[model samples]
Target: MTFADLALGEPVLKALREIGYETPSAIQAATIPPLLAGRDVVGLAQTGTGKTAAFALPIIDRLDLSQKAPQALVLAPTRELALQVCEAFEKYAGHLKNVHVLPVYGGQGYGVQLSALRRGVHIVVGTPGRIIDHLEKGTLDLSELKYLVLDEADEMLKMGFAEDVETILAETPETKQVALFSATMPAAIRRMSKQYLHDPEEITVKGKTQTSANVPQRYLVVQWQQKMDALTRILEVENFDGMIVFGRTRSITEEIAEKLRARGYSAAAINGDVAQPQREKTVNQLKSGKLDILVATDVAARGLDVERISHVVNYDIPTDSESYVHRIGRTGRAGRSGDAISFVTPRERGLVKMIERATRQEMTQMSLPSVDEVNETRLSRFDDRITAALGDSERIDRFRDIVAHYVRNNDVPEVDVAAALAIVAQGDTPLLLEPDAEPEAPRERRERTDRDRGDRPDRGDRPERRAPREGLATYRIAVGKRHRVEPRQIVGALANEGGLRRDDFGAIQIMPAFSLVELPANLSRETLDRLSDTRISGQLIELRPDAGRPQRRTDGERKPYRDDRGPNRPSFRDGGDRKPRYKRGDG
Candidate 1:
């Protein structure tokens, strides 16, 4: 049905028409009516399902323009999403006058947010941490808040903002209408909704498979270390008008964009770190054809509707099926056909199956583009360049005369002269990839036997010792046994944040107040900086290069490495006197 059928206000309808939004999406069609009736709503929908507009339209229609002490407050998980929601509110309220919307997140200056709040903003979109800061400082008055929205509640909790979110919710008036939107309703999110929302109308938008039916999805099984090579090969072979590469983190997006630029591709990145204005400009560049590729994290790429996006490349597989749908939905817009390719590591093969089950469509397995295929694509493009240049007679005549003179003066054959000129045009880099440098074929998938499916024996508290890997250096991180940090937690955080493969890590040793682990010796300054700021179990890692070997503990200082097994469990020393639970003859 049209937005008008949803009974949106005339001004809102005008704005929607101006933006070319004719019909309501499924989430909008289901949730907008209940929201307009001033009831609490629990919306279950993925990221790109027009959720912002679903809530934004109703809020704008019900806004009392005269009252301006933050009638509506939207809490998002990240700065990029906050800005995006704020922009959506502004866009929907364009026809209405004297309505100000402000976005407050950590990175931007508080002075700007304060000024906007002081000048009387009707809507405030912010991350939970900053919102809590404003509320504690008494800078934001939410007593008159008529609407409170917890957007992406699952993501907010995942980012460790649950306490901050509850604090903000408590500050609002109990009678304020609340709407909670999430892609997935985990137990935590469900418990939150029950505690906060009052008899909320639950709406679930399902079957995004239909939305992406026109798009073809494919998967490539590649090692983590070879993702870059696989991506380069795809770019060389795929004919795309505009492409988006999805990375898991902000740093990965920036890294991908930088490498693409260095390879002579017109690319840019948008992430939480990028300011809203710059992100807008980058998106505009992509729309205008000045940029051919956009590398982005999921939050940064929310609500992106670019008609020319012909391909979406998932450089890293998303952790969930919903995210997989949202990432690919960026393309295949406006009834245009699109392609989506995901680089799945061997460990992530199960995720592909999950995605297929969720989408009700099986993804075709794709091999890395062969060297012969790349060379053929390169030659075809080169021929096209020559054909285009032939139309420019003046420049071609000048170059032809120079080549002829060189051939005559050097007594070289005309073909040899042409080959030399071609080489010069191609630069020092090889025009084609070496056949021997091709990536290894994907490993054959094997079914898990009963033995493989069975649980393995536990390895105990501390990991086994091993020799240090070549080109790896021991580094110390500041949270350890005292902080209740575990070895797996450290490995997961470091490996994921640093974009390092599992093989890149050598060994890990947990000490009392610190731990030492081996990582790549030649980590870039940016990667190191990112690792330093990473958090494990709500504590900073503070990663630094270790010096000297760890000293052995004396007899009195030797305590169990971990004390989490409860006081009743026997300690290492106490266990020596206890009888074996299983005697040798018992089995």
Candidate 2:
């Protein structure tokens, strides 16, 4: 249906026309009406299904621009997403006067954010961590908040921010309307909806599968170290139009993009650090056939609607199942069949299985490309292009004249001259790549140490320690050894949950009861509120500024508190209340 049929305001309709959007996507058509009716919504739709505009349009139309305080708050899982949401709001509010939209996330300076908050933005789009920080600092006055949105709800859940989300929601005005959107509905998300939402309307749009029945799917189980060589071999052999390579981090995205360019493939990186204008330029280049390959992080590639994408290569398997679906969903779109190749390291096979079960699709196993096969493919392409060129009548006379002149000079044979020309055309580098050795399996009965839990550096010296910022705040999370949590899991969860990059974090120490993490001083109170709702490993993580050491229980027992009435409660010590409490000096 058309935007007019959706009953959007005149200004918003004009904005949509300016962007050349005439009709509403299925998700938008279904969600916009109910949202305008002021009903709580839980929308389930895949990426690239035009979900952003569905919420943005209604939110913008309903916005009271004259009000200075933030009336709407949208929480996203990543900085890129936060920025995208802010951009959408700006676009839809173009015709409105004095409308301000601000995006808060890690990796950006807090001084600037403080100034913006002081200036009083009308709408705030932010990641959970930063939003909570703002709430705690009282910089973000959300008492006037009328609308709250949780975009990519499942992503926040997987990133271990479910607890943080809850905390943020709790701080919001109870009268505020809430909307939650996700691509998949995992158990944790459903539990969250039950706890926070007030009888929300559920909207589910099934994703269209585009795996070609003719194009086979295969994966090579290789070590992470060997992935580069394997990918090079595949590129040499595969006849693909603009392959998309997926990486888990911005650094890896840049690294792979640079390597591909160095190897003579037209490549570019798309990530959070890349400016929006540059990202648009790079994407346009790829669509126009100027760029042959693109390496990107999942957040950077969200809502990317490019039809020329032929192959999606997962340079690194995603940490969670939902990400796998989003990554592969890049290639297969609009009734076009596509190929997705995942590089699965031995340790990551379990993750692959989780993804397979989540997507309900079985991936086929294919052998790695041999050196000979790559060479043959390359030579075949070269021969075909050259043959096509030679078939042009205008070019035949030029080639014949050159051959005649060469044969007349120095008694050179035509065969020898042709061989020389072929050698020159081959270029300097040879297309021979050696396969890497397989990774060793984890030992069956090994001692478990901090290093064994994927905490140690994968490649390099011990991580250098940095002094904590003097004015920075330290927060504690109720996750430690008891929950089988590791430093990387903590780091990944915080980075992904809080929308903080690797650099945004400070010192970290893990204790038996919880882990303490350092964050910037003068962080927003709103950010802190969001952080409290973050969950790690399906458990609510209690986040609060360093309360200067928790008070010890006078009962003198080292065991954790147990409440039998709570859901999923831990069992009490044997003998119940009759159990003796250990004294301080007792062994």
Can you give the TM-score per candidate against the true fold?
A: 0.72, 0.70
Tens-digit lDDT track for model 2 on 377-436? 877887897798788978788988988897998698888987777778777765333444
lDDT of 1 by residue, 1-587 (tens): 89999988899999999988888888999999999998999999877888899889999999998996889999887666787898889889889998899988754557998888888989999877667668878999999999999998877766556666787888899999999999889998999999999999999987654437778999999988898888888999999999999998777898899998898899999876676689889999998999999999876788898888999999988877767788899998756799999999887888888888878888999988899999999999999998998999999889889988887799999998778778989998898888898877657577788798566554343333433456777677888778776555565456445645444665566666877677878888977886787666567779977654422254535443443432122122221232322211111
Kindly give the number of clashing pairs for every candidate: 0, 30
Pick by lDDT: which candidate is best? 1
Check candidate 1 and list the clashing pairs.
none
lDDT of every model, 2 decimals: 0.80, 0.75
**C-alpha RMSD values across all candidates:** 9.2, 10.0
